[model samples]
Target: MSDEPMDAATPAGAEAAGLAPADRPIFFIHTPKTGGNTVISHFLAFLPVEQVFPPPPQLTLLDGDFATARERLPGLRFLHGHVRVTLTGLLPLERLRLVTFVRHPVRLVASHYLYFRHMPELPMHQAAKALGIADFLRRYPSYGTNPQTRYLTLALGLRRPGVHQEVSEQALAALEHFDFVGVTERMQDSLTALSEHYALPNFPPARLNEGKASRDEVEATEAVLRRDEFLMRLGADFLLRREAEERLEKWFATRRAAQARGALLQGLKGAAAMPWVAARAGDAALSFLEGWHPQGWVGEPRDGAQYWWTEDRARIVLASASGRGLRIGMHVVETLGFDPARIRVILGNRLLKTETAPAEPGAEVSFRIDAATFARHRRTAVIELAGPRSATFAELDPATADHRLRSFAVRRFTIEPLED
Candidate 1:
């Protein structure tokens, strides 16, 4: 990240200089558990008091209404709040530089679970009581599948709408419009990049939220377990599952090889076979063998491979392919609460609209896309089911447009020229 100061003539600095007040307030689209608070606070510190709009309560209706806020706070140069990023289109593009951050889904969810456990004022306990862990996990996709649902709706003062669509879909949609994307895992680096982008004097160290539950806390919570199970299931149905499986297989193989080498050096000539023989001779052998056999075949097992449906399986194979003009097939399976017919595929600035019929509960729906679309508009592709049956206007997060329903599972891939 560069440290050179931006001149007052520059767009960002012009807003800061109070010359031509920003046409569109600098919108900070906050994602929970993604260090949004720290980023907002840092900006508050550097920005003129009157120019800084306080972070809105989750999902408040202020997306395109900055004019009212600017009228009251004439010095306002920034409007930082929790809202859907898709709403950026509502603002004057040149004046607004959208920013947001993301974290690893597993860590984000775990952090969220802990944060809710401690904050009595937050809706976690009430939501949990109303919907127990099992029920919550089962319906979470419809309720909180989108990243927006998990954080924005509650944070921005948006009315708590009933489960509309998968929370994962909402998150992917929100990410699409961000001009600057930060990773929470590298907060300091992200902050540095932000400071450089806006030409701030210095970047402040971000404060870590305290009283966050530790790993043990997550391990102890039934909700966490359920959430993890749900995420794992989702990953399996999406591309991430394949990546995880491959990595797990590699790690297991490395460990086994190391163990075997150690045993050989220790003079255990038939050490590898000894455990199998010992287990076979004992009453506990059957159970031990059962567990060991599965553990040994960490990757796609030969027996399971036969049943493996690549089109529906969430694997990285398609995403890993090197080339432009490549075509890949994806199985849709059940559209769940969404209507298959209205699902529009958004690849960056381009929209690829397609009509699909519902598949059997576990069946796959195949769709294809060319590499040109992938390369030209591949930042993030969102599946939106927009219609009256999808969600009522009030049911939407106030910060987002009323007509849009998002999908949690986003398809991320890169494009390269195909080899001859």
Candidate 2:
């Protein structure tokens, strides 16, 4: 018996796989000041203007009449907006393809500040013109802290805009859902990639709403947008990694698997699985694959002992599943400011344990993983340690030159098998 669709609505991303475009329409989440106008111009060349939502003149409207818009949604082939990510809730997500562009937080905030100051009709123009960029950021963190991050995470139902100064696990996981995420600094290359992914004509780029700011102004603005900066770095890294997956078939399969895993993790909340890579040759000890700053240090074994430190969250992947229960232990040696610290241990998204670290070294924190837990997560056990406090050496002692924010340090890590 043959197994082919007899007239069913096409599956999402079917267009990318060479099926009909009408079934899987594109929804561009136009993050403001990220060269979105230029992208819209590119889309116009192929997608008819009549089939686009809230066309050119109204491009920046964040809240349009979505109630009436749904009546027109079926006929629309493309949609772009300066809107919240929650729009996905009202639309047919199963048939929609999501895309967005992000800029370096420094340039994005600078341009956003300058644009607000120059546009007299804007609500914040007077305030922007009245104060320096630093004052403006402090005065309006809601608008300045991480607007792009807020836009991307609006669907999460966060309490307020820019509420998080540090990137959270939920935010990073949220971004993975997008079909495409472009970086504004690499505008042309990103557009070309987008064009190929969607099988659309690649048109020459256009520049719109462009602006410039002094290095001082940009640096002052960038300091406050740490979350967005971290988010952009992750996106850039993903772009570089995506470039390495050259085979179209393999790339699609890999992404689909990741999407499936993410969905399962979300539904199960305490379950996990990712193809684990061996971190070291022996000793049954392993390093982390996620939930840490790109800058981390593994000190050389001194007197046959080694340690790890992170400026932010730290996680470790343990040995492959042995179908037996296990015990995991980590000894804390240093705290952010030579002060006692409280930390939480998380497995998948569930809280496994919490402990208070002594100011002195050699405080061991441990957790028990059952055989069923090992079987559920498959090849490895990924455990994360999170603390509420962080401080830099320079902040603690004026004499020091090291300025990177420091969390806690682990002097030793051990895993012990438990009787089944």
Residue 267 lDDT, candidate 1, scale 0-100 = 27
Clashing pairs in 2: none
lDDT of 1 by residue, 225-322 (tens): 45555565333112222332343344444444444333322222332443322111111110111111112121465532222111111212122112
Candidate with maximal lDDT: 2
Position 363, candidate 1: lDDT: 27
Against the true structure, candidate 2 reaches a TM-score of 0.48
lDDT (C-alpha, whole model) for all candidates: 0.44, 0.61
| Model 2 poorest 10 in a row by lDDT | 275-284
Clashes of each: 24, 0
- On residues 82-138, what C-alpha lDDT tens digit does candidate 2 reach at each position? 775475446555556777776765667777887887788989999989997767876
